[model samples]
Target: MSYLVLARKYRPRRFEDMVGQEVVTGVLRGAIEDDRVGHAYLFAGPRGTGKTTTARILAKALNCVKGPTPDPCGECERCLASDEGAEFDVIEIDAASNTSVNDVRELRESVGYAPVDSRYKVYIVDEVHMLSRAAFNALLKTLEEPPSHVKFLFATTELHKVPDTILSRCQVMRLSPIREEQIAGRLATVFDAEGVTAADGVAAELARRARGGMRDALSLADQLLALAGNSPQLADLARLSGGAGLQELLGLVDALGAGDRAAALDAVAAWAGREGELAGALLDVVRSIVVAGVCGAGSPHLEGGPAAGEALLARAKALGRGRLELMLADLIRARERMRHLAGSERVVLESALLELCTLEATMSLAELEARLASLEARLGGASVAGHTAGPASGGQLPVSIQPTPPPVGASATRSVQQPTGPATGPATAPGAAPRSPDTPQPAPGPAAAPALEPWKALVGALDARHRTLADLLRRSGKLQGSGSMARILVSKASADEQALLADKRSRRACERALSGAMGREITVEFVVGDAATPPPPKVEQDPFTRQVADLFDGHIEEP
Candidate 1:
């Protein structure tokens, strides 16, 4: 006899035999026992989760010869015939192959007839989502009000494709993927029954690789058995699956954490040479590292043994969490790209390893802040010392000496000169103070009064530094004071510009500029009111255009 694959050979013969689907099994069993069955039922979920199998089981429960029983008597001829796919009343259709309105119409017409031998006629439609829109519409009425003696079962991986009109007519049960531990336990039973002496870790690895699909897990185990013959060990399974040994993957991670690029690259090369599955190996290593970081060193459930777990913990400590997160993100991106780069797998894998090796191995954010603070202190001390050294003995500091003020004349000095007491000689003129031999007179203040609080100077600095902000501030108005607290009165025309000045950063900048101009600290305030008259909008000239005009001996117009 030909060897039967484990997937088919171990197919669940009874509801009790189904693994990791108790929710579905329990519901069906209750419905059967209570005789509260629906005319049409829909099962939806990921593949290999037993949707089709459950449909078959339900068929057997409904049509068994003994009675309409929850637990079908397998010994009976009707149940046995259904199990062998030879039952006359039970019909299994692959909707993916026959998805047309005509096919559905035929099904609808056939459902009118009663079962020949069984208690009810069962129609199981697999991949029902593949049906065309017209086909679904044709089946809708029949599904909603099928003959009393007929039952309909539909299974699909893509429930979204099934129209809501069709979905509302059936009872829907969503199936979940089987858990890894459950798959592992089932595989353990299979191994024991096959008289195979597999290592403890082998079944677990296969189960994880299956990604919660029992059929996939069973198929993978069957493949491993063929390659290793009976009594396969964990090490043998790992080698066959192109999976790097747990210890080796951990060592590679440690090398990367230490910033030992050469060692890390060498390890990657060795794994690539042995496994020829670089993407898979990289993904596995990345997954292990992430798990170890999250769960810590004592997690017994990690796919690789305890040694791999410890190595991951050590790497996590050495590399720090920030670097690990960045590396994981990079690996995820590389894994996605691997799908499209069919022929250049090795190049992609090596590039990912090189990136990992050159990862920024660094301390946590708090540690980095502390290191920066220390460096800044050292640099600040050096700057202070450099400033303390005096100018060279013969050298002089550059002094910006203003031209001696023109002898203060009567006309130019009157507006700013304070009234003087009786002049000692020649009766000094109106706006000029007389200087006495024994007492010198103080200098007159500015003609324009130097802007009450240097608010105009602050605005000028802002204009020079940032035109956008300056324009907004300019429309707002003139300064009203020169002391610590300075206020501006904005006209209604520019009230909308207040939002720009309200920003904390902009306010602080205005304060600094005001302080610099007035030679004292200053606070800024905005008051809304009508100004005497708004200032004319300043014109902006492009520097490049001005330079070109200068070269041509022409003036550039400001707009």
Candidate 2:
């Protein structure tokens, strides 16, 4: 007898045998038990996900010889015949091949008749979405209102292609892809039943490669078994799939995470030189890193040895979740581009590996913002100390000069008395002097100019420190007064300059400089005023004028 492939041998024989589709199974079971099964049912999902198989089981459950039982007894002739694909009452058609109006018309006509031997006539159309538009129109009425004795099961991977009109008439059951872990467990059972000795990691690897498809998993296992005689080792399975050993792949990831470009490039080059599957190797590495990140260290999901798994976990931690997600995206894009590139697989794989290795792990936006704040704080502090000093000449002061008391017994004391003559004002009390008519009395010696304040000192310091700023201050007539309360008359140009210096750091620096220059602390205050213009230039004699005078017979005197 020819050897039966794993896929066919492990096909679900009953509802209990179905995996990863408990919802659909339960609904169908309840329908069967309640005898409320719809006339037309549509099963839609991906390939190898048991759409066609479930259709067959449903047909058998309805057409069994005993009755329309929820659980068909396989011992009965009708059930046995249906399972073997030889039942006369159960008609299975490949819609992909028989998609014509004529075919649908014939099916419609046949549905009118009752079952010859079974309880109900069942028609299972696989890939029903492949049917032509005319075919769908021909069968629409029959599907919507089929005879009591006729049952229809339609399976399609592309449900969108099936018109909404047809979908509305049928009870649609959406089947999901089996989970990876469930697929692995099912494959392990198959391996045990087949007496195939698979290594520790082989079953899980095959299941992952299957991508939630049981048929594909079994097919992969069959090929491995064929290649390795009977007892397939993990290495053999990996070799057949063109995947690298988990340890090697993890090592590559570790190098990348550590930012060791050389090591990463070397590993990739070595893998590329080998005549194995570069794409598979790349995917395997990405998958292992992702799994490690999700599952944490010592996860059983990793196919490699414990050390390799631990390494991958470490790399995942170092690279972080954000980096790992970006790497996955880049790998997927590279894989797609590789198909179109006309170069050696090694070159393509190396390019992708190098890119991954050089990937700079990015911080979260929050973290970046925190860092920026820290930098700004440090800069502010430094600017306060280094950039905020008063001018070399010290800051301006508000002059309010008080006359020094006259030396004991001198006539200068009489000068403090008010003038009595017409040329001067009436005599005032001692220490109170009246203004002289001709001299205006100098306003009590300029009110003894006020002491210089800290802010003025700081501005002075800034002017001394920055030449450009000093030039700007001089040009704008910002320099004013001679004491603490001295105001820097700010013209429009100086106001614009002040606006430029309005940043928090710059303002703080100026404050610090002012504080240092003045004995007391001070703050900045702006006042607007028109700037004083410079007088017209006057012509002056040069050194050449004296030299010409010495050369001539006459002296060069001022005109």
Candidate 3:
């Protein structure tokens, strides 16, 4: 005897045996039990999702010798006939082959005839949407008012193709795709029944590859069992599904995380010549990584199971949420672009992958923000050595802060603690004994004046008269000093700022603004000394940046 495939051998014999479609089955079961079974019913959903199977089971339930029962007795002749697809009262038609008006007319004529032996004549039409417009029109009246003994069951993947006239008469029951876990569980049952010893992840991998089709999963399992015999390896399942092994997918992600371009490229190159859908496999693995990152390592969506979660969680964390989002976007775009581009799939896919691996070369806004956030956290807790704490030269309380010079063996806490008086009282004279708090306070110096808080007022005073000079003075240095002598330090200023401030006119306007603001003659001196603001230090490149620069044959440019 020829062997029956698992899809057929394990076909659901009753409504209770159906998977992932509780609502549809429950409604049908209730309808039969309540004796309110509709004369015409429409079962619509994707292929291999039990639309046709449900139709057969419904037919058996209506035609069983015991009665029109919700549960069919399989031992009954009518139930056995329905199971073998040879019931005289249950007519199964393929609308694809017989789509003409004549075929539909014949069907209408047959509906008037009584059941040969069962309780009702059941017409099960697969792909019922394929019927021509003329065929649908010819059958519309008969479908609306079929013989009381005749029950119609229509199954179609494309529901929209069926005419409204036909659909309005039928009780539409939509079936859903089976869940991955459900499919995997069923496959495990198949493995036990078939006496097969499969790897732990093999059934799960097959179920995922089924894309929510129980029949497809069972068929794949059967194919793998035939090819690999009773003991099927994980590699056999991987080969059957046209997906890379879990370890290979993990290795590629690891290469990306470590910025190992050669390794990443080698992995891609290895799959370039393979028969399987490499892009799809990579997409699935990447999707799992992203889901694991967002929902955590325990997410049920991780296709490779715990090993995948453990292997990819660190890499996901390392890539960060933003970079991972961009990578996923790039991957999706590459897949879409490949659909239209023939012979360029490898080049496009590899280029996109390389870009992800070397993301620093083109940091997205999110990636830049992520980098800045990390830097900010590190800087917030940082300490400087010998950092000075002094008021601005203008007696301006503190428009800007300066880092103290490193004092040997001591970390300096830079504070913006400004005194109500000048010079913080002479800086304690380098090594003099600390002054007693009760010691008489010194009188105000000639340069000491009430602090000018709004530096913009001083700058704006000259803005109307000398906009360029105002801009230069504004850009040139951190202001300090007070009445009669306003100092503008120029050492750390940019070359252009220094040159602009050095001009005689710009200096005179700055002096005028300072004097006006102080309500006294303020001599502005542009000084260069230890007190001058220091130029910003060059930022050291991180390894991620270095790797990106190396990959792109580029260097970091200063802004």
lDDT of each: 0.64, 0.62, 0.66
Better of 2 and 3 by lDDT: 3
| lDDT by residue (tens digit), candidate 1, 1-559 | 8998998888887899999899988998898888899988999988788898899889998888876787889989889998898989999999999999999999999999999989999999999999999999999979877899999999999999999998898889988988777888999999989998887788877776676678888888888999998888877765565345555556676665544545754664565433235555556666667677888877755654576578777776666677788677877776766667764444455555545644543344455345444434533443222213322222221211111122223122211111122332222233232222222232322311445224444555554333444555554454544224444434332222332333333455565566566665555554333333232222212222222223233211221
Q: Which 10-residue span in candidate 2 carries the lowest summed lDDT?
A: 412-421
| Tens digits of lDDT, candidate 3, 1-559 | 8999999999999888998999999999999889999989999998899998999999999888886788999989999988998898889999999999999999998888888888899898999999999999998989867889999999999999999999999999998878888888888988898888888888887887776789888888888988899888887765664456667777887666554545766776666644126676677777777888888887877665777677778767766766677667877887887777776665556555655554432334454345444434543453322213222222222232222112111111111111212333242321111122233322333443332322444555444434444454455444545334444443233322333343444555565555554556555545432233332223212222223333333221221
lDDT for 161 in candidate 2 is: 100
Instruction: Using TM-score as the measure, name the better of candidate 1 and candidate 2.
Output: 1
lDDT of 2 by residue, 47-107 (tens): 8899989988999988887657778899999888987888899899999999999999999
lDDT (C-alpha) at residue 290 in model 1: 68
Superposition error at 199 for model 2 (Å): 2.8
lDDT assessment of candidate 1: 0.64
In candidate 3, the residue pairs with backbone N, CA or C atoms under 3 Å apart (3 or more residues apart, or in different chains) clash, namely: 387-404, 388-404, 392-480, 393-480, 393-481, 394-480, 394-481
Clashes of each: 2, 27, 7
CA lDDT for candidate 3: 0.66
lDDT of 3 at 256: 64
Model 2: residues with Cα > 4 Å off, grouped in runs: 242-288, 298-311, 330-360, 364-559
Q: Model 3, 133: alpha-carbon shift in Å?
A: 3.4
Instruction: Pull out the clashing pairs in model 1.
Output: 453-481, 453-482
Off by over 4 Å in 3: 241-286, 301-304, 312-315, 318-559
